[model samples]
Target: MNRADETGLAARQGAASILTAVLKERRAFDDAFIAEAASGHLRNAEPRDRAFARAITATALRRLGTIDHILSLLIDKELPKRAGATENILRAGLAEILFLRVAAHAAVGMNVEAASRDENARHFKALVNAVLRRATREGDAILDNLDTERLDTPDWLWQSWSAAYGEETARAIVRMHYADPPLDISVKRAEERMTIAEALGATVLPSGTLRLEDAGRIEDLPGFDDGAWWVQDAAAALPAKLLGDVTGREVLDLCAAPGGKTAELAAAGAHVTALDRSRPRLDRLEQNLSRLGLEAKTVVADATAYAPGRTWDLILLDAPCSSTGTARRHPDVPHLKSPADRDKLAALQARLLAHAATLLAPGGTLVYCTCSLEPEEGVRQVEAFLAAHPAFRRQPVGVEDVAGLGEIVTGEGDLRTLPCHLAALGGLDGFYAARLTRAS
Candidate 1:
């Protein structure tokens, strides 16, 4: 086969693998990508081909609900239970033609060819071509008339977000997830923000984050190797900043794997001990710290069980959640997470919060946060924690704490950032954080 044909086949195969991992194995896209890359499925492809595969997978997953909705209109009967792979091929094709704006003829042809290569799917090649061709002709009109917010969001998630943030805000958040998020970077020194922004033609946020329209190949960017900055979302950067001046203080970062916040605390001159349960994820955090020329004592232990031998002056627990807030970047998150998972995570967060309170010194601050839009994981978690621990009191974040993100602060003084909060300047992940202090 020629180079172009080989590249197309590789991309389609990669997309199919990603879809199967997500739909059948229930794997997160990031984990699936890592698995694919480690298996040489992606490693063998050219850099451009690898990128295309990734884009196709993300696009297909992100718009899967809408694509499926359109596909159902074209199909005469329900797809067979065993036709998952064939269905994914059709989804990929529709994604390319409808969302990615690829030429319909090429998109349909490539996907049909992809289907023909599989014995199980070969029999469905005609079906794939027919459905996709009909999609190309009528999909846009169907999509235009569909209630995308309802179709794209899972019923449980839609109900939860809508009940919490209201219908209008929930719709806005769902719409924002359809587009790729911009890259936000946190610099080692605030003084260097302007210089780096100028170099990359990026915008500097009020919170000192450098925002790039598109940060392709982050390692290739200037100052990346020099340890001048690190990639962090504007919303993700807030929890550490809420601590306010951790210099010389003993800081504990719980569940701090992939430690952007750990680097933030260490860079702020705090003596930080970053702890996580996953050794592999901690390894990545250590690599990030090394690249940034920063230091933090790393521990591979569960946050609830670790004993630091001393009470921390400041503690940041970036607890795990459904991570629906990051759907914009991950795309597969909305498909992979379920309401039951959120409930289980909320229970864990409550335990972690209670445990973290015990580790904080009298008069020291503890920040509880989650990359979740769910109240059970964020607002209610903190409220319940306060009720259970009489010694701890809400610190109430002020306008000065988040800089430009003052609008997202709740009346009760917690930070609740939504994907729609900074809509005009791209958007932010839905994050909730509450700063609490123990009475001395």
Candidate 2:
């Protein structure tokens, strides 16, 4: 179906249709679905209406588990199957009343009216109305008593972080996801940083990253077409910076694709060799570098297997992982991932770290990083690699090295940027990074 049709189906047809389309089609949250379904049709949705629809959809998805919990307590019979339109209408209405704090009268009136738009949804009207009213009246009790800490997060994720960082820290991390993340951009030329910041009315972060309140359509930004800047998070930029004084050195960006780190390396005057297993991803890297007028020796091969003719002074392994740390930017990741996925990715990271170590010249640096919050994929992976390769030692980052990053460093000196830490500035993605040196 066309985008317009899909949205119409979502809004008029009920919340279940939108959620169904997302799960079955494996698509991102269809704000359009919520809008069309919420509005009873898809034509001419203004920006404000679209925003409200998006908020409604996001609230429901984020609190899907809790909403279900509330339903189980109130429903006399099992809620209709998820694929049914009845269940979806209930979910959307519950999300608004319970979580969104949307005014009860307005929320109920709109939901009931929206449900009547489709005959299939008619059966759900009584259920939706009763549950929403009960939730609204007793909402304070539910909000006060239901574990806000566990409301939206998976059990494994909540338990893991709580065990590692304490309940307060875990709750703080969870709280950060309730809001939208700011637009963080990394400039290609240091000189353009100020100009871009001024145009967007943003502040220059201590780490030299740009933090815009909300710069829509990055490509439309003043310097974007000119290739003067690219979008990289403040935390993601640290791996390249940790290599320290890379001028006139040869570096390898292993598994570099959508190559932000590669661009940073090239900008730092390193003759970079970029390698990846996927040719299409490599092609994107080449295109990015070309846009910035930077050059790199591009190779399409598995980083674990490809053998370049010579060793290099530095190598960066932005290893794949569970991506738990990036929940704010990519909320869908937590839903798609399983604990098994985390374990599997950890095993792969161990292999990539060992393999990347071999390509670093004696006395050179190997910076390992991942957008994963799990210790198995971060600290544990590094510890395992160090045990196997005694010649390499953890050269922990110093507090003075990276502005605004010293606080997130673990006792062992690895970088760990959590969403909670960045709440003041709209937060940053979770990341783990460590620098290792090979014995000469």
Top-lDDT candidate index: 1
170-204 per-residue lDDT for model 2 (tens digits): 99988887777788878877877798789878888
Model 1, residue pairs in steric clash:
none
* Whole-model lDDT, model 1: 0.88
Judged by TM-score, which candidate is best?
Answer: 1
lDDT of each: 0.88, 0.78
Instruction: For model 2, state the Cα shift of residue 185 in Å.
Output: 0.6
Angstrom error of the Cα, residue 147, model 1: value is 0.6
* Model 1 per-residue lDDT tens digits across residues 1-440: 68787777778777777787887899988888777766845768877777887888888887787888888888889888767579888888888888898888878888888888876788899999999898888888888899877888889989999999899999999889988899999999878889988988898877788899867899999999999999999999998988998989878999998999999889889999999999999999999999999999999998887776878878999999999899998888888888899999999998888889889999999999999999999999998999989999999999989995678899999999999888899899889999999999
How many clashing residue pairs, candidate 2? 6
lDDT of 2: 0.78
TM-score of each: 0.97, 0.88
